[model samples]
Target: MLSLFPQILFLAPLALTLLRVVLAIYLAYIAWYLLSRHAEIEHAELPIIGHARHGILWLSAISISAIAALLFIGAWTQVVAIFATVISLKQLVFYKRLKEILPFPPSTCILLLCISLTLIVSGAGGFAFDLPL
Candidate 1:
C-alpha cells in the first residue's frame, strides 16, 4: 500500500472534505429535525441553537473544504488542509451541546466532541504525513 500512497495522498483530502460535508449534513438534519419539529411532541434532545447554527457551520465548512481541496492540489504552500481540519474541529467543539450551560443536552456535546476529536486525530496524522520538511 506504500506504493499507492502517492495516489492516495493525492486523493485523500478530497475524500476527507467529502466526509466532512456528508457528516455535517446528516448532523444538521438530525439537529434541525429534533429541535425544530419534533421537540414539541417527543422531547427532542439536541439543542435548538444547533439547528440554526448549522447554516453558519456548513458555510464555514464549505470554505474550509475548499481550502483543503486547494491544499490537496498543491496550489498553495504548507498544510492548509491541516489548518482547515483544525478549524473545523474547533467549530464543532464551539457548538457542542451542553444542557445546563447550553440549552442542548449533554449527549449532543459528547457526540460532537467525540466526532471532532476523531477528526482532529485523523487530521494530525494526515498533516504529519502531508507536510514538507
Candidate 2:
C-alpha cells in the first residue's frame, strides 16, 4: 500500500485538542449568554419540563460555566465530555423552545455533540490531564 504525508500523522492529537478548545469556548459562550441575559428570557415551557424556572436557568448557567472551565484545562475530559454530550443532546431535542434562551442555533448544538462524542471515545487527546490508566 502506498501512503502520502505520513509525517503529519503524528500531529493527530492536536486535532482533538483543537476540538476540545473549541467546544469549551462554545460552552463558555453559552454560559455567559445565559448569565448576562437571564433576566430578559421570558417564561416558557421547556421540552419534557412543564415550565422553565428562573432559578433553574441560573443554576444551569453556573454549572455550565464550571464545566467549560474544566473542559478548557482538559481536566477530567471524558467525564466533562459526557456532560457536554448530554447538554448538547438536550439542546437539539428542545431546540424550538430553547432557541430563545440559548445563544447558538441547533446546528451548533449538533457540532458540539459530535465533538463531545469524539473526546469521550478518544480520551482527551494531547496536553490533557486525563492520563491513560
Candidate 2's C-alpha runs over 4 A off are 1-3, 48-54
lDDT of 1 by residue, 1-133 (tens): 5674575577665554444444454444443433443334233234444333445545544664555455434333234434544544544564544222232354554554454444445542233334342
lDDT of 1: 0.44
Give the clashing residue pairs of candidate 2, or none. Answer: none
TM-score of 1: 0.33
| Model 1: CA > 4 A from native | 1-8, 39-117, 124-133
TM per prediction? 0.33, 0.87
Model 2: per-residue Cα lDDT at residue 59 = 89
The Cα error of candidate 1 at residue 61, in Å, is 18
Task: Pick out the ten consecutive residues of candidate 1 with the lowest summed lDDT.
Answer: 124-133
61-116, model 2: which lDDT tens digit per residue? 88998889988888999999999999899889878866777787889899999999
Q: Best candidate, TM-score-wise?
A: 2
